[model samples]
Target chain A: MDILKEISENLELGDFEKVSLLTKKAIEEKIPVEKILKFGLIGGMDIVGEKYKTHQIFLPDVLMSARAMHAGMDVLKPFFIREGMPNSGKVILGTIQGDLHDIGKNLVGIMLKGAGFEVIDLGTDVSPEKFIETAKKEAAYIIGMSALLTTTMPMMRKVVELLKKEGLEDKVKTIIGGAPVSKDFAQSIGADAYGYDSTDAVESVRKLFNQA
Target chain B: MRPVLRFLEDELIERIVSEARDVLCKLGVEIHNKDVLSMLGEHGAKVNMDKYHVLFTNEIIDKALKTVPKSFKLYDVLGNQTHDFSGYDVYYTPGSAALNILDYDTNKIRRPETSDYIKFTKVVSGLKNIASQSTALIPADIHEKISDSYRLYLSLLFCEKPVVTGAFTIEAFEIMKELQIAVRGTEKELAQKPLTIFSCCPTSPVKWSDVTSQNLLDCSRFSIPVEFIAMPLSGFMAPVTLVGTLIQHTAETLSGVVISQLTNPGAPVLYGGSPAIFDLRFETTPMGAVETEMIDCAYNEIGKYLGMPTQAYISLSDSKQVDAQAGLESSMGATLAALSGINNIAGPGMLDFESCQSTEKLVLDNEICGMTLRMLKGIVPREDFPTLPRLEELLKEKHLLISEHTRKYLKEEFYFPSSVIDRANRTRWEKEGRVTLIKRAHAEVEKLTRDYAPSRLPEDIKKELTKLMMGEARRYDMKRLPEIEI
Candidate 1:
């Protein structure tokens, strides 16, 4: 079977070992990195997402396949990046000030990059000024803010205040989120958008882009 | 009539509060972590020159406790809000699952981005059973520095019900404000009342870190009803006995309430504790242990008795995952919580002894919550006492009421889950295809995600968001790359 086909199939099956083996073979054959990334890896993930969309796959299966994809990517990581530049997208991500929990935010970051968004992760405990400054410096269009603490949930709103006060809110479309954050809060805070799950965020962005 | 537990006495409330203050004030809760000592000193608590502990008298606590609000309001999607959380009208606070997607490209695990939330919201917005929505796990923005921001935005679009969520940094808070405006169309309307968020201070009986203090200040200033979750690992970070543990929990929780209210008086606060004991055997805190349940029950009683709305971390277990242990522990935990009449139940789908979160477990726990609520409904009368002639005629020499027209409503009158639990007989089940509980749950989860189409977002807003994201990519010197063909 074609190596790409094998790799994609293994990823579909959530077989990490097979993915690794196929990855090695594909690498030995000197398969193009871009092709494997798109046709093999990304393709497999898309299928997994769709499968998840339906009843064809579940969390454990997705986790297992993603793990397998990780193994295969490890072997080819050095080569892919060394051979060429790492894939990148423009993103500005950070946890709101006074808040430090990031499991949800971090997960969003991973999915963003996987979906081909260039990510700029500002570590947690970030402030409003810091976000504005970074967004300005990077000229980032989408500024992502996350808060996991109820105490800090308001800080996500403060970032919006800073942006508005600085006249940066319009220039940068700010998106806010966390366990306690809601669309109502997002709108009241004057943010561009809010998301519930990581994947839904990705699709929302894509939809936004298409509409734009 | 409900069985009243003696733990709910008002005298006990007064005693416990006083005792907790005395212990902290006199003994000055030990400076277990040096860093915490510095933070407390910085935060206005007077530290003895020696810095072994910080002395705060009963007066200070009394004064601080005065700032805590009894309740706050959360506006609904229709603009209606509720100050009380004990409506007993089940509200949705985001699904209890930690969903992750691996970036095969990056070979790293990450939370999904905006698109993830958009889909979820479409479903959530449509869910009548859900009282509120969550910022789930997606962030709304795309940050080349970290990850995506879908979870953040979807909280705006999904359920439209009040959201249960938090922020990681101040800037994120700003975006959250903007998103609220986007959803509701006016920041002024959004700010008319307090927005509640559950911010976690570092596990207490341990120490309050600097950031944790900052988080408190942040929420207090914004008037976000804050639920300070005080998690103390017993026998490790806390005391070995239940009484000692309660004292420790009281100190920690009271301290947070004081700080938050002081920062902003009348700011709503809810007292909560997820206090559990370490098994010593597994070297892990068994969330399923009866002791854990007892501690929660005791703490909840004390808090509510104090005239504060309470939050309890219940419906959780010590199991590693969703299995028999998970079922047993969750059933007991949820039962204790519902019967105890806890205002809020956290860690519903938490598994692996709270080490991890699971989607499967969340869906299953939702079912459990339903069942538990039903159980709390107490027994109902079958009306078979007299064996009336009419009913006997309907039964007519048969032990079954199969021919009774009223029987048709029996299924509707009773609630049944389609997955994760089985009710079919051996032969029917086998014939229908012997599906395992987990497998059935998996199927259910898939169906939910697939069919879930929450509320919709305005077209203009979506377009604006996308334009910004792509522009951000270009600004970061990123390539548009190629299209992902389905």
Candidate 2:
């Protein structure tokens, strides 16, 4: 039996310690790094993502499997970086400036991670300048912002303007969400898209990549 | 003609009561207040002072149960006896201490001020089915330390009906008593008339805090009727099963009864509860959930079995707004509690998980309470069992709309809805601008508040009441209290 097949089995089963040890064992066994990343870890996570979409698994189950996939990825990441980073695009997520609410943004981050996107969480009370700098430094393709207070919703527009000012508007798409964020507000702010909830945010991010 | 609603069989009642007694004797209850421990010890309870747990034997519990008066009258502002809270009779009031009011016109949720209390009381006074008053809104503008006293003061001034209100601190409790004394003339007369039923709650998981325990003692000493509300959140503070939760409720309520009796024999107390199932998903005690209604009905059954006057927090909705969910949950709870023969049904006009109040909901629940009362009245047997004469009359008429018997029985037998409920014909309804229940209720509320004229207090007593309240305010360095135009 292939060791990567066993790694996929353990990853799907959500056994993080076994996934980590098996990935190390596969590396020692002279398995190709791309096959381990694609056929083993990503393959397991793809099944989890489908299960999550179809309601076969819930948030807690998806979270556990994502954790297992991360265990395997930790062992294989150095090899992938040397091989020029064979992975999905990056997404920078945060609550907008002067807003201390990050629960929605954190949920979107987890779902994005489960769907194989590398997410950089900037946390709450995040300024627009910090979001643009991180997107440029990480070469991220998407910037997602959340604000639970209507008072702080205007900060999302500032981030979009900063992206345009830095000449990264064409390269990066912007998405906004939260209790107060609406489609009309998104349009008025000139955002690329608006998500009603975290699940909708995942679908919108996937659509953005599909268009690219 | 009112049909009694009973849920428990004799055998099951006996079983639950016996189990509760066994729990009290064996498991005991934790009382953090040393004075309560001493009081229970003096009354023959096996109190372990170091452990702060007192074990009540069957003899002690029976003695305490006997001391509580089975019936009492709650008085209105004019010193007239209002609802007789005894046996199967039930009264309705809005839930208290809501932090915000839903501005119906603006469709905005904001903190309620002293002005909102005036409006709330006026609406409560106008509604016929809302039998009592509660300081429903805890104004955000008042000083936090004196807010409870200020709420009672406002209730005494604006409300014509007796209030279902309480105190937070010992000073607030004394001040509330002073306010009641001002209305009743003397402390003895106030105790005899009982303008308010002070509510004291014991913290869940079988622990009594110092403040609530002291309140029990004060209520006993003052001879004021007290409502012992034991709220247990199932699966968290209490057992997850309904039967287990009931056992805990029985034990906690019985413990409070024992304390009240020991403080002063024949201290009037009402057995009441607002137990709810803990929602593990949201980590909230959803009071409007169906399981909560079931808990209420089941506990009231135990209360009636003990021959105790019972109160249940019902008719409260968990909806954040006055939407369909609010109507459904509120009506369901009101119906269930009333049908279960709860004596004092206290939860109406409350929304957003009991943290907010709305005037529209108050008027809406007035209709619900009327319907519930009618349902509790059941089918009447005015004549003999045969009904041959009525049958013949019905057959002869074919249409009983204008029959003499139909006209005679119309007001007595049926529940008549007021303007808040829409029952007009389609053509008339359309011609009337298709008025919604909310719109009618808003109009009713506006008219009620605008037309309200409070019972005038004597100048000297009014000044005395103001001076007493100001004395407390001065202690807190509050320069200005909310002015009252009434």
Candidate 3:
């Protein structure tokens, strides 16, 4: 069997150790880093995501598979850097300022990373300047903001405004989420997208890349 | 026999009540309101002002229980008594204070404004099985300072039924009384023909905060029935064991009852609760969980044993959307609450762990309530003698499909669900586009609104209410409320 297929199957089984070993063996056997990432780790996570969407697997099962995929990604990440190749793309995420809630944002981050995106999680209470600075530093394409409070939903709009002021409006896509944030609010604030939940966040990022 | 659901034996209920009294006497309840503390102290409660504790003796609780009437009547807008909380009469009201509403037209969830509250009130007013209306959606357009009183004003303006609502602050509580008095004409008449029952809650772990305790006292003084809602999050703010939580719940409720009765000897009170097990994984109170239904049933048993009219937060779904989980959890909780003989079940139309309100869910839950109440009625054999002869005579025919007995009792015996619950075969259902419950609910809402005429109110009273509400708005530095076309 192909090594990428083996790695994908092991990741599906949530056999992190096996995924790591197979990924390393594939590395040592001279498979390209980008090829291993796209055909193996991302391929495995795509199946897990679909399984989640279809209700075939729940949070715990998907989380276990995500960890296994991450294990494989860890083995392949340094090789990609050494070979001067991007994994998928960079994305910056955080719960917006005045909001201390991050569980939903963290879930989105995990899903993004599982989808093979290199996520720079800015954590909670992130200001618009912080998001912009991190997005600039990471050269991230998408900036995802989450706010659990209605009072802090405007911070998402401020971040978008800041991006526009910095002339980065066309360069970076912005997505907002949390309990109170909605698609209408996203449109009202001129955000590039709105993610109703964590899985929708990953899909929004994918759609952004596709549109680009 | 009537369908009955009980979780605890009479002995166990007594034991739980006994332990609850011990909890109150030993640990004591924390009452933050100074007036209530002083009042409790005057009533021979062991009050520690510095510690904010009021320890109730068996004498205090027994006296209070003796004075608390087993049932009371709630009146509607026209000063007609509508709700009789006498015995096993269970009524369903929608969940209260939801910040967001699912807009039927947009099919989007949004923070509701006053217009949306009006829409919700109209929909609820039309739902026949829903016994009372609640301020199901909080308007986001109003200022926080006036929101509570403003919501009460809207309830008075729109709902003709007895309202189930409450106030956030002492000022808001006073304003609510003013609105009630304006509707009922005078303070004495307000007390006599109470058009609303105020729900006052005690914080979990046996604590009654200053505001809520004061609201309890205010309601008692006004002669409005107060629903003492004790929400104990099991395993977190409350004890992990169901019995342990019940002990806390009973203690909290008993303390409220004692204070309320002391304030006014014959004040009406409802023993209501909204308890849920703290889910370790989700870190949420699953209002629709089986554990919640069990707790509601058990707590209600204690209420009945104490001869108090009871209420429970049931018919609520934890599901974010109206789907299978929503149907399963909501129907299960509603059925359990109904069978348990809870006097008032207040959670229809609530979703997302009771955070979001949906009129569609309310319509759907009206159907659920109808089914559950039908189940609660059980089967009533009309004739004293066995119908074996009639059955034999019917069986002699080719079929009993058109028997005289069947024709006589068919509609009376079974609850035929309205158009929302599809009972048609697959062929006919698909031919009719296989509409889902939510879509059907949307259609129901549309039909109701299109056919809607404002409930009759005297023109003078209407103008007075408008003037009073506008006066409130002007106090918040506004000329009038935001307008929406009726």
Candidate 4:
């Protein structure tokens, strides 16, 4: 009875168990892994993102969808690696050093993952060097830093300076965000962009790659 | 005799208060300030340091309630008593901290500047029914760092009424407290008269941020009157039911009371809230919603039962313009809040969910407030012990227009609205250019601003206020303060 449709519907409902079961069932039926990942998993998340953007759904609903998507993706990851299905992009995200606030950063991570971007979340209190070293190691397309305190806002500037010194500014784009961060602060620090909120973070990343 | 509105019976109020106390004792409230958390711990509360939660026992709650004054008095800049925030005596002030002003000329909402703030102060100063002036508009021309204190400075310079103000940052409180002191000369005199009432809001669903908690502690230390604005959006941040929201409001407010009383016993606080029904369709908190007003009245009853002065952000509209929607919503809110005996009714000149302020609407709401105050003075016999005498006099005169009884009680019995109410007949209305309510309100705003005299504060006090504000502005890299015509 249309196993991929069942998977997508279950993902949207945030039923992680049913989504995982349907993904395993689709794989057993010998449907191509790419079709399940695209039409089954990412298809459901796109709806969640749009509903969130329009305020038809709220944060809890979006977070539940992200969880359901992860459960299905866990089962599909091995198949994709074997078949070499490429993700849209990779991003490195973290809260700058001396700032412990991470709720906003975590929400952006969830939304980025829902949008089909592979997000490497370096947890809160991450140093500037850790952000760049990991970006260079993982070859991330964008590096996102967050700072909730005015004191820790300077760390974002340090990350930008290190990126310039290493001449990786052309290859890797930088985006700064937090309660105290603004577009003017971003320009003054020589960063590529500033994200006003979590939803805006996804759009900013897409703009950096000319994907929007 | 005063008309009163009661939404909850004694049994229901007792049940609700019991439930709130149980929630506070069992679930506890999360306070982000370290000093407050430890202080609560020292005061016999069960403190969960790891989670920053404090559980209050019945004894602690009772002790705090006993010390809270049932009422307080507010003094104007000249040390004249302006407001008695005691039982059933309602006072109207403009809503505070609006980021936008509904520009009279453009008929559009835009970021307010210092000039707009000055004009708002001038208009509020001229308003008769609005008892106190609020630091209502946040001027965009100033630095965000000093916006909180700057609003107060403008209100003190251009207006004389006791201000209803608040601070956004913990550091800003020092300057705000100093500004109040500059008016009254010293901390002791300032505390004695208490020229300002600070609004300290707790985060909804039983939590207080570090900044707001610190502000409460500081206000308590100086004996400054504070109103705990606990905003719980029903169906969203709070339970979907009205009673459930009331419980949350009670618990949040009680936690603030305990904090203040712990800092200094007998600290004055008003049981205030700004709860709204979160409209699922629009994803907005409509303050003017009927259920929102019901929550306000119900909680005011609870506050009165608890023996504390009450405040609410009612008598305001969520409408984007000063249209029929604004008038109806605001009138309904004012009537309900006044009958419910909310002592400080802080919602005039407010629109767009309290984000925008219009001086034109302030003029209209002033009349609404006057009507409500008149309604509060329910049908009472003035000089007519026998109704037959009044009827005979009315029958003899054929009209009571020039009779002694009419002359004595005409102003008392009837609320005379300004020209904004459109009392004239259609023919006369047409003769006067057939002006709409908006046009009439705009003209009144212009007349008030033009007729406003500069504040009568002593020249040295004015100079001192300017110097202190200039020092604060310079700290944020602003070289000069904005010029005011006065």
Candidate 5:
């Protein structure tokens, strides 16, 4: 990958061609995927994630970063498909039903990518049935959920219960996060993890993987 | 200092109280939900929940009013005396209420960098006319090297008067100590000159956060004065009537008084409230309207009646723009706050219904503060008339009253605007950039931010606070920060 393009894409500050060009450059140069993941994606996302936490950037920045991350990821998608393998872990994510906010969930997705995990972002307001079905089909190891509004935090509990009812709870790890979600709250809701931000979300997933 | 201003003398206060009283007794204030009604009834208030209205006899009102304390002190780390709200003028700002500008990197609004916060505070501090300044905006420019006490460091590095602020966590409070140490020169001194950090209770009838409660206790034990700021949305959260709102305010105040005095009686507690009806039409809380005047008059009376010093939110507004509406609201609010003898007023530099802060308004409001002081001076009587044998000499030469003494009186009594604001004739005013007050204000803010000199803090103390903030920032593994040009 063109180092500049990949770095800019991973940073979430640029657009599609920025990442495509960087990826194409790296591919032409025969640079390994592992090095591209660490130097470009990891480096870029580190900047974006910290900025989000400090009020220097807002939701629009998060969206832009996610788009860039995807642009870079798109080039790597085919290589992974050809190899028929996934790096790190497979995680499924969504904003619980009734909560339409996607900012926090999207950041978590970007951070997960930076952490070298494949994240299936189930766009917000996802129902219990959809979560169970996705977990089954993707056979994802980690279940990451986010909620921004207080009114929708309870869905975290409901989704967890529904997963148990479908007998998928033990089969997969469940984590919950959002503005309203607390560490104590996560325990009360019977979720395996609780994250307050993108960094916490990544850390929790890493811990989950370590324990497994 | 001028023996407390009377709300009755303030025309706006009178208008607001009478209008609110009529609205309550006639149309009545909305109780809205049954929960609020039930809560009031439990406190001996008569509630017509179906109509969403409440009525309280003087007896219930009195009982609630008795619960509040009149005066409170804010202490710095040295426990050096800074402000006493009961009978002094105190001015502060909002608690960074909205999640605006953030660090481009972390994207969290933890704190703005020390340099930025200092610049912001210096503008207010140098004004000197401002009584108290509480600005706890996070420093974003600082890299995520967490453990640094950004808020405390900046307040310590800049401000001179009492700073109204709060702690988000215990670690943050430790940093606050470092900030305090930096200002007062010694830990022992800051402990003695403990600051009057303001704690905000939930907006009406809501339980105080456990964290907030704990912080209050901690501040109390340290001899730091505490001010309980109860912000109730009249049409939304509290009573719809002026009197009912006072009762709600009374309950909130009384509970804090009990807690404050319970922990440290005469612990220098001040009673204050920032309540106004929510203008549902605009989806905003009108803080500087007649509604705000009523709030100041009634609640201040409750505090004064209890023989305790008081404070309230003045210099407020619900105008969405920094236009005539902004001027009207802020002017009226500042008048009410001063007239009612409030010890502290937060945020007068707001426009667009208090949604935005403008530097021009800051400069303009500084002028207004001077005007309000003149108004409080009240009508000058014959006592200062000088019997003017000198003026009489000039009168002897004139047909009527254009005497030199009269000229002197006119020149001395009338307050003049500074050159930045156009007070000149239209012909000349058109030449100076046609610059509106806001444009001038923006320029002023930029200048102040750049020219501000950081408060000289003791090196060790500054280092300690910085360490705490930077360390705390890092626990969350906060690394990079946004690049802010300003």
Candidate 6:
């Protein structure tokens, strides 16, 4: 079997150790760093994402494959930095203030990482000011907010307003997603995009950067 | 011969209990309240102050279990015993704390106001099969700060049944306790015959929030009966496996038991939970899912093993409307919960993952509850031992419909549902306007609301309740409460 094909298959199977070992062996065998990342790591995640979007696999399966892809990425990261290859983009993610639900937020973070975007997760109950400060400090390209409670959803509007007040709305796009959030709510709150679920969150982020 | 259902065998029950104790000792539970942490530290448990985690020894768990009353009685506002949560008897109540209500008129899910809650209370009071009334809907008209106490106040006024309620904030408990005390005339009298059971839920994955922790402690301090709502969403907040979820449920519930017992020994509590299976497709917790129902029954077995009265949020549906799915899911849940012999069975009239409640569905579920309760009586020889005599009477009369034995056991042997259940022949059904279940339920709701007489509370107590509620309502900048015809 081709070594890259073996790596992609292992990553798809969520065999992190095997994927990492194969990526290391491929690196030792003089495979280009970009080829290892694209054909080996991203190649496996693309299939996982497609399967997830098609409902052929569930969230847990997608999350496992993401972990395996990260294992492969760990081996290719130093090489990518040495070669100055850019990542997908940096996105700041968190559950809005007064809400302790982070599962949806964490799933979005995992999918963003699986899609090759850099995710700075601030965890749950994150205030609006913290989101703005993090985006400014990280120079992030997007701010994604999640909320599971209708009560805490209004806090998402605060984050959007803060982005405008800080004059970062043009620079850092804001996207919101959760069970209680809707496209109408996002538009009402002046948000740039609304993600219906984790899969749509990635697509929305891609669209925000005109990469879709 | 009463029919019963057991989801776990003796050995599995032991294993689950032992594992839950092990989890408490090893993993411990994170409590957000510092006072609780210090209290646990004082009680000889290993308390991690920095993390607010308390690791309990088996000795502490055993001590708490011994103090928990195996059974307790719930009383109505008139001081009449409404429920005896002992033996294998099961009682049904509507599920609580829904954000929205399915409007019977509009056929839409909308936020409930004070009037909606009053109508709910009035309807619940007339429900013969459902034994207790819950503070089911959160009224959106009131200030969120007073919403918790407002529901309790309304329930007390409009209904005489024992209330199943909980507080959202620590301050709300004071007013709620005051309301109960006013009804019972004193703190000691209220505790003696508890008029309410506060639901103190522990956050899944073995954690307790500050507000919920305080509510648990307050209920314990007053010796008010509490049901520890250990809501472990399977495969999401908790483990993927059923047994894994049970262990988390046990651990979380035991942690609550320890807190309540340590605070005030002999605190009345019911081992209860609202566990649901996570639907991966929609990312929703479907309470009506079979796995969720199994989790509810399985935990009831565990609760029984611990010698505590059990409560479960079963007999509910995830359907958006009162349709076939609602009927199927709710009847399945009610039947299973009844067979399991859960002491306090909640989730009647609940829909959309317990986020919405429907009065039409409540009327429908009352029939379901009546049927399930009759099933619990089981088949027994009721004067049928002398089969020859009844056979002769049937043969002589060519029908036994008016016979002595048939007439005697008519009400006992059969569950006669209300008009909500369509049991008539096709001709009669069509003659009765060809009404749907939702339509019949709408008629029933209106009839029940119209027929409900005023509650029998004394005039002085009624005035006291109004005074107390108005005082709290004014604190939230409200001058007047909603108008109720009753």
For every candidate in turn, the CA RMSD to the true structure comes to 29.1, 27.3, 24.5, 30.6, 27.4, 30.2
Better of 2 and 6 by lDDT: 6
Q: Give the TM-score of candidate 1.
A: 0.57
lDDT of 1 at B156: 47
What RMSD value applies to candidate 6? Answer: 30.2
For each candidate, the DockQ is 0.01, 0.00, 0.01, 0.00, 0.00, 0.00
Question: What DockQ score does model 6 reach against the true complex?
Answer: 0.00
lDDT of 3 by residue, A110-172 (tens): 778777788998889999999999899888899999999999998888999999999999889
Off by over 4 Å in 4: A1-212, B387-391
Candidate 2 lDDT over residue span B190-226, tens digit each: 8888888888898887778888898888988988888
Cα-based lDDT at residue B334, candidate 4? 97
Interface RMSD of each: 21.0, 26.1, 21.5, 28.7, 30.0, 25.7
Which residue window of length 10 is worst by lDDT in model 3 chain B? B395-404
User: In candidate 3, how many Å is residue B298 off?
Assistant: 0.6
Native A-B contacts reproduced, model 6 = 0.00
The sequence of per-residue lDDT tens digits that candidate 2 reaches over residues A141-211 is 99999999989999999999988888888899999988778888999999998877655688789888888
When candidate 1 is compared with the true two-chain complex, its DockQ is 0.01
Give the candidates in order of TM-score, highest first. 6, 4, 3, 2, 1, 5
Tens digits of per-residue lDDT for model 4 on B366-390? Answer: 9999999989989998888877887
Q: Which has the higher TM-score value, candidate number 1 or candidate number 5?
A: 1
